[model samples]
Target: MEKEIYSLRSQFEIGLVTDTLVMLLDRGARVPLIADMPQVIPMLRGLLEGGLRHRHVYCRDTDGVYTEVVVFKERYDLELIESASQIRHFNRVLAKDSTL
Candidate 1:
């Protein structure tokens, strides 16, 4: 019998950050074996503490629509740059009419 390979797609991806760790949830499973990236923990912490902002852009296609989260680091000079090791996507987006 030939074994069939299957690919699982996660409906949602969640990140939980602490002072020392970042955890992810996908496909109803907890993924705890993430690589030890030094900046990720602190950046996530900053984001939780309101020191960072997450921006979203939505794109429409013939099939449907998808959202993109803009991730970048801004320097003191206000120039935005991408970090090679930074996370490329966040699961949540702030609504434009949100009161928070």
Candidate 2:
């Protein structure tokens, strides 16, 4: 995570991505895994509600899955993230737009 992002998360009730999740942008993941993150993050958010804790998110890859534990801020935006299906569709549109 960037220092600025960490600061923002600390000061504001907003969302920020973890370093482990950040790597997913460069290295693609399995479709099911991609689809599952939104659901998982929310479940994790629910667990950490009103508490300071860390949750481990397992990244699924063709080789296998790797674990990345993230400390979600207490006020992380649970409603900001969209569902995996929505993400998939949005990404498809971006891909198409880039090709045009």
Candidate 3:
């Protein structure tokens, strides 16, 4: 199971929005594994709530530099989080309009 889980890790990415919010992004074409991985949710939450002593995920910052980010996964309702693609599309449209 460890090998399977590790393999699936590449299909998704996680981002920290705030101390109490997190964003999960699907990088693969397959259906998101979020629904299938129920056990991961509580583990993520525990790590977040447990404070800085826990391990962190390395992520790329806005400057394209990799940094260790502490994820706080407080919200479990997937419907409340917005997808990265939608945010990108909105930014593109906003930038286009601004140039006019």
Per-candidate TM vs. native?
0.20, 0.26, 0.37
lDDT of 1 by residue, 1-100 (tens): 2222211331222233334333333223232212212333344446455533442212211222232223355321111224333223322321211223
Give the candidate order by descending TM-score. 3, 2, 1
Point to the candidate with the largest TM-score.
3
lDDT of 3 by residue, 25-56 (tens): 44453544454245445555565665433443
Structure candidate 3, residue pairs in collision: none
- Per-residue error at 7 for model 3, in Å? 4.6
Model 1 residue 32 distance off true place after TM-score fit, in angstroms = 8.7
| Count of backbone clashes, every candidate in sequence | 0, 0, 0
- Candidate RMSDs in Å, in order, are 16.9, 12.8, 11.6
Sort by lDDT, best first: what order?
A: 3, 2, 1
Which residue runs of candidate 1 sit more than 4 Å off their true CA positions? 1-12, 15-23, 26-33, 50-100
Give all candidates' CA lDDT scores.
Answer: 0.29, 0.35, 0.41
Q: Identify the superior model by TM-score, candidate 1 or candidate 3.
A: 3
On a 0 to 100 scale, what is the lDDT of residue 26 in model 3? Answer: 42
Q: Over all chains combined, what TM-score does candidate 2 have? A: 0.26
